[model samples]
Target: MALQHGVTHLVLSAFGCGAYRNPPQHVAQLFKQVLMQEYDGKFSQVIFAIYNDANAMRRGDGGNVEPFEKEFGIKASVFKEQ
Candidate 1:
């Protein structure tokens, strides 16, 4: 595990939300629960990187923005190149 190896920061992808057929919102909520409640402060930072393609854009929402904001009480930021 990353924690066992003394990893401070973690870049987490959307687990089971794609080919595994798991619900995106549910998976986001579960990740928040485990990271915040179960493994509180274990990592210096936890980043969720969601990639959006044409198909995902067609679906309107392809990332965990709302779920993550609701769970963490903060908004996720998007970095754009100028």
Candidate 2:
């Protein structure tokens, strides 16, 4: 549908990985598989927008981004306390 409408950029998120309790690693892998095998070269860019609050991290909650960072081998955001 997006391609048919000439949309080039895409934005996605860690769906079902928060209050729904779906495993973020598994979700990330599924997204990777589809994006790589099915949507490759079909869009100008694809952005995975994952965000977690500082308070959430302080409470030991990974929120939505930690598992994705781990699955994708991305270092967690480093921000010193103000």
Give candidate 1's error at residue 82 in angstroms: 11
Give per-model TM-scores: 0.70, 0.70
Question: What's the C-alpha lDDT at position 59 in model 1?
Answer: 49
TM-score of 1: 0.70
Off by over 4 Å in 2: 53-62, 73-82
Clashes of 1: 0
Q: Score candidate 2 by lDDT.
A: 0.72
Error of 2 at 9 (Å): 0.5
Cα lDDT listed for each candidate: 0.67, 0.72
Residue 68's lDDT within candidate 1 is 55
Q: Write the per-residue lDDT of candidate 1 for residues 1-82, one digit (tens) a residue.
A: 9989999999987665554545567777788778878789889888887644333344456544455566667777766445
Clashing pairs in 2: none
Please provide, for model 2 over 1-82, each residue's C-alpha lDDT reduced to its tens digit, 9 standing for 90 to 100. Answer: 9999999999888886655666677898888788888988999987677655444345365766777777667765544446
Residue 61 of model 1: what lDDT? Answer: 60
